[model samples]
Target: MLGATGLLGSKIYDRLHRNGHEVLPASRATGVDAYSGQGVAAALTGADVVVDALDMKTMSRRRATDFFTTCAKNITATAAEVGVGRLVCVSIYGADDPDAGRAYGYYAAKAAQERIYASAQVPATVVLSTQWFELIEDVVRRASLGPVTLLPAMRMAPLSADAAAAAVADVAMNPHSGPTVVVRGAEEADTLDLARVILQERGSIAGRRPRVLRQLPYLGRAIAGGALLPQEADTVVPGGIRDWVRAAH
Candidate 1:
């Protein structure tokens, strides 16, 4: 697995490993940088398939675009050189829409990566997934200022890392007929509500629920509304929100 070390990537590696697949965890820490060709050739030399789960911190728009485009170029070139058969990439939901109002840079990078992989000689699958349940706590942890936690007013079907890994693994092991697939959680959730749950569970707030405020971009309400819950189809998973929170805990 190319990413093999991030929260999702680590889960993918563990799932694939438990399923008895010979796995390779490629990353800068492992001496294989996907952004550079340094050790990629050797890492991918005998691998049958590759899965990409690399991530950048915070999903900054400009940085994410550059990171993904560059990473895709590097991975594709090296995978081709090493004769890898298939590539599976984990992407964010709504990445294909040029106008999806996702504020994170990672979304644009994912879209660019999709285009690059689509044009590659090797077969590829891009599995676009909804938000991960872990993100609820993450956003709260990061966005919480004083006693309040600000959140984007958006819809999300937050999947577990394991479920997402299973989806990606299925794509990696199977034929790539659908170059793109959407994988969603079992239940839809509000970002603020999810944050509230986390905050309550973690004992971050007491008494009344901390204010649930909508976060707006300086651009305008259009960017905030459109970039965030742009409509999309449901990507089904078996477990529900409670299950995801339990697993995460």
Candidate 2:
């Protein structure tokens, strides 16, 4: 498991480790930096399947593209050299679809990342997942001004990190899924409403200075048009925002 210490990565690591799998959790903390290509091949020396839950904390087009593209090259080259069979990578829903809003900065970088991974030697099982309920807090923190919260007016079916991690870990261990797959939540919701549910549940908005929520077309029209939602055949993990907060908090 690469990037095995981050928000989603840690959940994947714990799930696999707790289930009696010999998961080689790799990250900067363990001296395995995928971005730098240091100690990456060594970690995959005897591994059969590699799960890439790597992430870059940037929304800039140039920086994100550079980071993901470099990481993909380094990871794929190393994995192919070490004879790793499959790479189970985490990705966002509609990353490969032009209509799903790749015009956005980060989404465009993700599409670039997907292109490199798709052309690599090792067969990759791209787990295209929807936004996670866990991301609500991060969005709120970044989009908030003094007393106003600016949100993207996107329609999403957000699942829990645990649910998405479970699916990723399953693919890593089983390696029986298709080249690409979709994972999502039980129902669709407006980003504004999702934020409200989380904020209210956490008591973040109750005692705060008078606050307001506003929606902006941060990702253009595709997001609000439901282009990023789950496909009809996709199997959604059960639970919604409230379910996640109750279980996690």
Candidate 3:
């Protein structure tokens, strides 16, 4: 299991371990750097399945593109050399769509990563998931200014991190040979509505209302209307934004 210390990766590692699977959790902290191929071979020795949950930190176009492309190249090469059976990658819901947030460096990099996996020698399964409920706070913070928050008027169906992890684990263990599989939350909502719920939750927590005006705009160049929304054929998880927020608060 690569990136075993991350939010979703940790859940996958725990689930695999609890199910009596012999899983090796590898990451930068464990001296397995996928970007440089350092310690990757030793980690993959005697391993049959590899779940790649690796994530990049940068959003710069050049840096983000290099980070994912390099990591994918190194990881796939090493996994193929080791004769790994299946390579499961966790990507975003709209990564395959050329018109979905293409201007965003992160989205473009993700699309490149998917392309890398699709052509890899080892059989690969790309599990695309929607935004996570855990990211609401960060999105709110980034969209906020002095006294106003400008959110994108885009539509999305977000799942909890746990739900995403569960879906990833199922794909990793089952070993499916397919083009791609998308997972999303049970309900669809606009970004503004989700932001409102987040603000309300925070206000209830602090016992005081936050004085902030909400507005909408086309945040990403390629995001408009329901462009980021998953298709009807995609798998829908059980929890929605409201259920996740209520349980969290």
Candidate 4:
């Protein structure tokens, strides 16, 4: 697992290890730079399949593009150079969309990375999963100012990070001869509605009354109008907001 420390990467590394697969956790934490080829070869020395879960979490266009683009090029080159057979990557649901938000520059960066893999001779599969439940929490936190909270009225089918990670492991174990398999959550809920549920649950313990402001006019309309919806379906992971919260609690 390339990004063995992230939300998904940690879960993936654990799942693979617990399932009896000796999974190696690769990252800059281990002095292995997936983007710079510093320790990539050494880290991937004995690995048969590589799961790239490195996340470039930033709002800057240039930073995001640089991260994933460089990651894609270096990972593909090094994996092929090391003679690794299959590569599995965790990408966003709408990463291929060119009109996604500037905040979604990471998605565009991921897409650019996919382009490198697509052209590479190494067999690779990009698993595009929907936003996780924690993303809902992030949206609420970002929009919150004291008691008032605003969220994108947009729709989301938030998947479980653990399930997404498991799916990545499954794909890695069974190397596929395809371009990419897009996975979304079970059901679609309005962003505000989902936020309300999460806030209400967390609010019980956190002692905060978060008011939801949905789709206020102006730029809010653009945010509310399906800016983050998955257009295709391949594999839908199980679990919902309630399930996630229950587990977290």
Best candidate, lDDT-wise?
A: 2
Candidate that beats the other on lDDT, 3 or 4, i.e. the better one: 3
* Clash count of each predicted structure: 6, 0, 0, 0
Give the per-residue Cα lDDT of candidate 3 at 81: 94
What lDDT, from 0 to 1, does candidate 1 have?
0.72
Query: Which of 2 and 4 is ahead in lDDT?
Result: 2
> How large an RMSD does model 4 have?
2.6
lDDT per residue for candidate 4 within 7-98, as digits (tens), equals 88999899889889988787777899987889988987767888889886676768988888888888888888888888888887666766
Query: Candidates' TM-scores?
Result: 0.85, 0.93, 0.92, 0.88
Choose 1 or 2, whichever is better by TM-score: 2
Q: How accurate is candidate 4 locally (lDDT)?
A: 0.74
Candidate 3, which ten residues in sequence have the lowest lDDT sum?
A: 204-213
Q: In candidate 2, how many Å is residue 47 off?
A: 0.7
For model 3, the stretches where C-alpha displacement exceeds 4 angstroms are 204-210
Task: Give the lDDT ranking, best first.
Answer: 2, 3, 4, 1
Q: What is candidate 2's lDDT per residue for 10-69, written digit by digit as tens?
A: 999999998888988888878898889999989988888888888988878899888888
lDDT, candidate 3, 102-154, per-residue tens = 65668888889999999999899998898888776666666666656666566
- C-alpha displacement of 17 in model 1, angstroms? 1.0
lDDT for position 157 in model 3: 85
Q: Residue 127 lDDT in model 2?
A: 85
Deviating ranges (above 4 Å) for candidate 4:
101-103, 204-208, 215-224
Cα error of candidate 1 at position 147, Å: 0.8
Off by over 4 Å in 2: 99-102, 205-210
